[model samples]
Target: MKTIITSALVLGLSLSFSVSAVADDDAMMQAAGKELFNKCSACHSLDSSKNAFGPDLSGVVGRKAASLPRFAYSEALQKSDITWTEANLRKWIAGNDQFVPGTRMRHVEITDKAEQDYLIAYLKTL
Candidate 1:
Protein backbone atom coordinates (compact mmCIF):
# COMPACT_ATOMS: atom_id res chain seq x y z
CA MET A 1 0.00 0.00 0.00
CA LYS A 2 2.83 2.39 0.80
CA THR A 3 4.51 1.60 -2.54
CA ILE A 4 1.29 2.31 -4.44
CA ILE A 5 0.83 5.61 -2.60
CA THR A 6 4.38 6.63 -3.41
CA SER A 7 3.89 5.83 -7.10
CA ALA A 8 0.71 7.90 -7.20
CA LEU A 9 2.45 10.84 -5.54
CA VAL A 10 5.28 10.61 -8.09
CA LEU A 11 2.83 10.57 -10.95
CA GLY A 12 1.03 13.62 -9.59
CA LEU A 13 4.28 15.53 -9.19
CA SER A 14 5.33 14.64 -12.73
CA LEU A 15 2.01 15.87 -14.13
CA SER A 16 2.29 19.10 -12.18
CA PHE A 17 5.74 19.76 -13.58
CA SER A 18 4.58 18.99 -17.10
CA VAL A 19 1.71 21.45 -16.81
CA SER A 20 3.96 24.13 -15.40
CA ALA A 21 6.47 23.61 -18.21
CA VAL A 22 3.77 23.92 -20.83
CA ALA A 23 2.48 27.14 -19.28
CA ASP A 24 5.95 28.58 -19.21
CA ASP A 25 6.50 27.63 -22.86
CA ASP A 26 3.24 29.25 -23.86
CA ALA A 27 4.11 32.47 -22.04
CA MET A 28 7.48 32.55 -23.72
CA MET A 29 5.93 31.99 -27.13
CA GLN A 30 3.44 34.79 -26.51
CA ALA A 31 6.20 37.15 -25.49
CA ALA A 32 8.11 36.35 -28.66
CA GLY A 33 5.00 36.93 -30.68
CA LYS A 34 4.42 40.32 -29.04
CA GLU A 35 7.91 41.34 -30.07
CA LEU A 36 7.20 40.29 -33.64
CA PHE A 37 4.09 42.48 -33.57
CA ASN A 38 6.31 45.55 -33.63
CA LYS A 39 6.67 45.09 -37.35
CA CYS A 40 2.90 45.25 -37.72
CA SER A 41 2.36 48.23 -35.42
CA ALA A 42 3.11 50.66 -38.21
CA CYS A 43 -0.17 49.80 -39.87
CA HIS A 44 -2.16 47.99 -37.20
CA SER A 45 -3.50 48.66 -33.73
CA LEU A 46 -3.78 45.80 -31.24
CA ASP A 47 -4.88 47.50 -28.07
CA SER A 48 -7.94 49.33 -29.29
CA SER A 49 -10.79 49.21 -31.76
CA LYS A 50 -9.43 52.21 -33.64
CA ASN A 51 -8.49 51.43 -37.21
CA ALA A 52 -5.32 52.62 -38.83
CA PHE A 53 -3.98 51.57 -42.19
CA GLY A 54 -5.40 48.22 -41.17
CA PRO A 55 -8.38 47.36 -39.00
CA ASP A 56 -7.75 46.86 -35.31
CA LEU A 57 -6.52 43.37 -34.53
CA SER A 58 -7.61 43.14 -30.91
CA GLY A 59 -10.15 40.40 -31.62
CA VAL A 60 -9.02 39.16 -34.99
CA VAL A 61 -8.37 35.52 -34.21
CA GLY A 62 -11.89 34.22 -34.64
CA ARG A 63 -13.33 37.18 -36.52
CA LYS A 64 -14.72 37.05 -40.02
CA ALA A 65 -12.69 38.58 -42.82
CA ALA A 66 -13.57 42.14 -43.78
CA SER A 67 -16.19 42.27 -41.06
CA LEU A 68 -15.38 45.75 -39.86
CA PRO A 69 -17.86 48.04 -41.53
CA ARG A 70 -15.77 51.14 -40.93
CA PHE A 71 -12.59 49.85 -42.47
CA ALA A 72 -12.58 49.81 -46.23
CA TYR A 73 -11.37 46.33 -47.03
CA SER A 74 -10.18 45.11 -50.40
CA GLU A 75 -12.79 43.68 -52.71
CA ALA A 76 -11.05 40.34 -52.72
CA LEU A 77 -11.16 40.12 -48.94
CA GLN A 78 -14.74 41.27 -48.74
CA LYS A 79 -15.74 38.48 -51.04
CA SER A 80 -13.50 35.81 -49.56
CA ASP A 81 -16.01 34.91 -46.81
CA ILE A 82 -13.26 33.73 -44.53
CA THR A 83 -13.15 33.09 -40.84
CA TRP A 84 -9.84 33.87 -39.22
CA THR A 85 -9.10 30.36 -38.02
CA GLU A 86 -5.59 29.70 -36.81
CA ALA A 87 -4.74 27.79 -39.99
CA ASN A 88 -6.08 30.60 -42.15
CA LEU A 89 -4.29 33.16 -40.04
CA ARG A 90 -1.04 31.25 -40.57
CA LYS A 91 -1.56 31.27 -44.32
CA TRP A 92 -2.51 34.92 -44.26
CA ILE A 93 0.56 35.85 -42.29
CA ALA A 94 2.78 33.77 -44.56
CA GLY A 95 1.45 35.59 -47.62
CA ASN A 96 -1.69 37.66 -47.80
CA ASP A 97 -1.49 37.99 -51.55
CA GLN A 98 -1.33 34.25 -52.00
CA PHE A 99 -4.01 33.67 -49.40
CA VAL A 100 -6.33 36.25 -50.89
CA PRO A 101 -5.37 37.49 -54.31
CA GLY A 102 -5.36 41.29 -54.53
CA THR A 103 -5.52 41.78 -50.78
CA ARG A 104 -4.80 45.42 -50.03
CA MET A 105 -2.68 44.72 -46.98
CA ARG A 106 0.94 45.23 -47.96
CA HIS A 107 2.31 42.99 -45.23
CA VAL A 108 5.64 41.31 -45.84
CA GLU A 109 5.39 37.56 -45.67
CA ILE A 110 6.56 35.93 -42.42
CA THR A 111 8.46 33.01 -43.89
CA ASP A 112 9.71 31.51 -40.64
CA LYS A 113 7.28 28.93 -39.36
CA ALA A 114 8.49 29.34 -35.79
CA GLU A 115 7.95 33.07 -35.97
CA GLN A 116 4.49 32.49 -37.35
CA ASP A 117 3.69 30.15 -34.48
CA TYR A 118 4.90 32.72 -32.00
CA LEU A 119 2.85 35.46 -33.64
CA ILE A 120 -0.23 33.28 -33.62
CA ALA A 121 0.24 32.53 -29.97
CA TYR A 122 0.36 36.24 -29.16
CA LEU A 123 -2.59 37.01 -31.36
CA LYS A 124 -4.65 34.42 -29.52
CA THR A 125 -4.18 36.36 -26.30
CA LEU A 126 -5.79 39.46 -27.79
Candidate 2:
Protein backbone atom coordinates (compact mmCIF):
# COMPACT_ATOMS: atom_id res chain seq x y z
CA MET A 1 0.00 0.00 0.00
CA LYS A 2 2.84 2.44 0.83
CA THR A 3 4.62 1.67 -2.43
CA ILE A 4 1.41 2.19 -4.44
CA ILE A 5 0.62 5.50 -2.75
CA THR A 6 4.13 6.85 -3.23
CA SER A 7 4.14 5.87 -6.90
CA ALA A 8 0.76 7.53 -7.43
CA LEU A 9 2.00 10.77 -5.85
CA VAL A 10 5.07 10.76 -8.06
CA LEU A 11 2.95 10.17 -11.14
CA GLY A 12 0.63 13.01 -10.16
CA LEU A 13 3.54 15.41 -9.73
CA SER A 14 4.95 14.49 -13.12
CA LEU A 15 1.59 15.01 -14.79
CA SER A 16 1.15 18.37 -13.14
CA PHE A 17 4.55 19.50 -14.31
CA SER A 18 3.77 18.44 -17.86
CA VAL A 19 0.49 20.34 -17.86
CA SER A 20 2.19 23.47 -16.59
CA ALA A 21 4.89 23.21 -19.21
CA VAL A 22 2.30 23.06 -21.97
CA ALA A 23 0.81 26.35 -20.83
CA ASP A 24 4.11 28.09 -21.51
CA ASP A 25 3.47 27.60 -25.19
CA ASP A 26 0.62 30.10 -25.09
CA ALA A 27 2.98 32.86 -23.99
CA MET A 28 5.56 31.84 -26.53
CA MET A 29 2.93 31.91 -29.25
CA GLN A 30 1.88 35.41 -28.25
CA ALA A 31 5.46 36.64 -28.47
CA ALA A 32 5.97 35.02 -31.85
CA GLY A 33 2.67 36.51 -33.04
CA LYS A 34 3.79 40.05 -32.21
CA GLU A 35 6.82 39.61 -34.44
CA LEU A 36 4.59 38.50 -37.29
CA PHE A 37 2.38 41.57 -36.98
CA ASN A 38 5.34 43.88 -37.53
CA LYS A 39 4.74 43.37 -41.22
CA CYS A 40 1.27 44.80 -40.77
CA SER A 41 2.50 47.88 -38.92
CA ALA A 42 2.85 49.72 -42.23
CA CYS A 43 -0.84 49.65 -43.02
CA HIS A 44 -2.58 48.89 -39.75
CA SER A 45 -2.37 50.06 -36.19
CA LEU A 46 -2.86 47.53 -33.43
CA ASP A 47 -2.68 50.26 -30.85
CA SER A 48 -5.66 52.51 -30.23
CA SER A 49 -3.51 55.60 -30.52
CA LYS A 50 -4.23 56.09 -34.23
CA ASN A 51 -5.55 54.70 -37.44
CA ALA A 52 -3.76 54.06 -40.71
CA PHE A 53 -4.83 52.80 -44.12
CA GLY A 54 -6.59 49.96 -42.35
CA PRO A 55 -8.72 50.42 -39.28
CA ASP A 56 -7.07 50.09 -35.91
CA LEU A 57 -7.08 46.44 -34.89
CA SER A 58 -6.93 46.89 -31.14
CA GLY A 59 -8.99 44.21 -29.40
CA VAL A 60 -9.79 42.57 -32.71
CA VAL A 61 -9.29 38.99 -31.62
CA GLY A 62 -12.96 38.24 -31.08
CA ARG A 63 -14.52 41.34 -32.57
CA LYS A 64 -16.93 41.24 -35.44
CA ALA A 65 -15.55 42.05 -38.84
CA ALA A 66 -16.03 45.63 -39.98
CA SER A 67 -17.32 46.59 -36.58
CA LEU A 68 -14.90 49.40 -35.98
CA PRO A 69 -16.43 52.84 -36.12
CA ARG A 70 -15.14 55.44 -38.63
CA PHE A 71 -13.67 52.92 -41.04
CA ALA A 72 -15.47 52.79 -44.34
CA TYR A 73 -15.96 49.13 -44.77
CA SER A 74 -16.84 47.99 -48.22
CA GLU A 75 -20.27 46.49 -48.68
CA ALA A 76 -18.59 43.18 -49.21
CA LEU A 77 -16.84 43.39 -45.85
CA GLN A 78 -19.69 44.92 -43.91
CA LYS A 79 -22.18 42.31 -44.99
CA SER A 80 -20.07 39.20 -44.53
CA ASP A 81 -21.02 38.59 -40.87
CA ILE A 82 -17.57 37.28 -40.18
CA THR A 83 -16.13 37.17 -36.68
CA TRP A 84 -12.43 37.12 -36.01
CA THR A 85 -11.16 33.90 -34.49
CA GLU A 86 -7.81 32.23 -34.54
CA ALA A 87 -8.86 29.96 -37.40
CA ASN A 88 -10.72 32.65 -39.32
CA LEU A 89 -7.84 35.10 -38.98
CA ARG A 90 -5.59 32.52 -40.52
CA LYS A 91 -7.85 32.23 -43.53
CA TRP A 92 -8.33 35.95 -43.89
CA ILE A 93 -4.63 36.68 -43.72
CA ALA A 94 -3.79 33.89 -46.12
CA GLY A 95 -6.29 35.06 -48.75
CA ASN A 96 -8.51 37.99 -47.99
CA ASP A 97 -10.27 37.76 -51.31
CA GLN A 98 -11.44 34.24 -50.68
CA PHE A 99 -12.66 35.12 -47.22
CA VAL A 100 -14.46 38.23 -48.36
CA PRO A 101 -14.98 38.56 -52.04
CA GLY A 102 -14.36 41.97 -53.57
CA THR A 103 -12.57 43.28 -50.49
CA ARG A 104 -9.46 45.42 -51.00
CA MET A 105 -6.80 44.00 -48.70
CA ARG A 106 -3.75 42.82 -50.67
CA HIS A 107 -1.42 41.27 -48.15
CA VAL A 108 0.57 38.28 -49.23
CA GLU A 109 -0.17 35.09 -47.31
CA ILE A 110 1.89 34.48 -44.16
CA THR A 111 3.41 31.09 -44.91
CA ASP A 112 4.94 30.09 -41.59
CA LYS A 113 2.74 28.16 -39.19
CA ALA A 114 4.72 29.39 -36.24
CA GLU A 115 4.29 32.94 -37.45
CA GLN A 116 0.59 32.50 -37.99
CA ASP A 117 0.22 31.01 -34.53
CA TYR A 118 2.15 33.91 -33.13
CA LEU A 119 0.15 36.46 -35.11
CA ILE A 120 -3.08 35.07 -33.74
CA ALA A 121 -1.63 35.15 -30.27
CA TYR A 122 -0.69 38.79 -30.68
CA LEU A 123 -4.06 39.67 -32.10
CA LYS A 124 -5.75 38.12 -29.10
CA THR A 125 -3.75 40.40 -26.87
CA LEU A 126 -4.91 43.46 -28.83
| lDDT (10s digit) by residue, model 2, range 71-101 | 8888898998999987888988887888889
- Count backbone overlaps in model 1: 0
List per-prediction Cα lDDT, in the order shown.
0.91, 0.83
* Highest-scoring model, lDDT: 1
- Candidate 1 lDDT over 20-107, as tens digits, reads 9999999999999999999888899764656589888877999999998788999999999999999999999999999999999995
lDDT of predicted model 2: 0.83
TM-score quality measure for candidate 2: 0.84
Instruction: Please provide TM-scores, in order, for all candidate models, with all chains considered together.
Output: 0.91, 0.84
Worst lDDT window (10 residues) for model 1? Answer: 45-54
The alpha-carbon deviation from the true structure for residue 65 of candidate 1, after best TM-score superposition, in angstroms, is 0.3
| Candidate 2 lDDT score at position 48 | 64
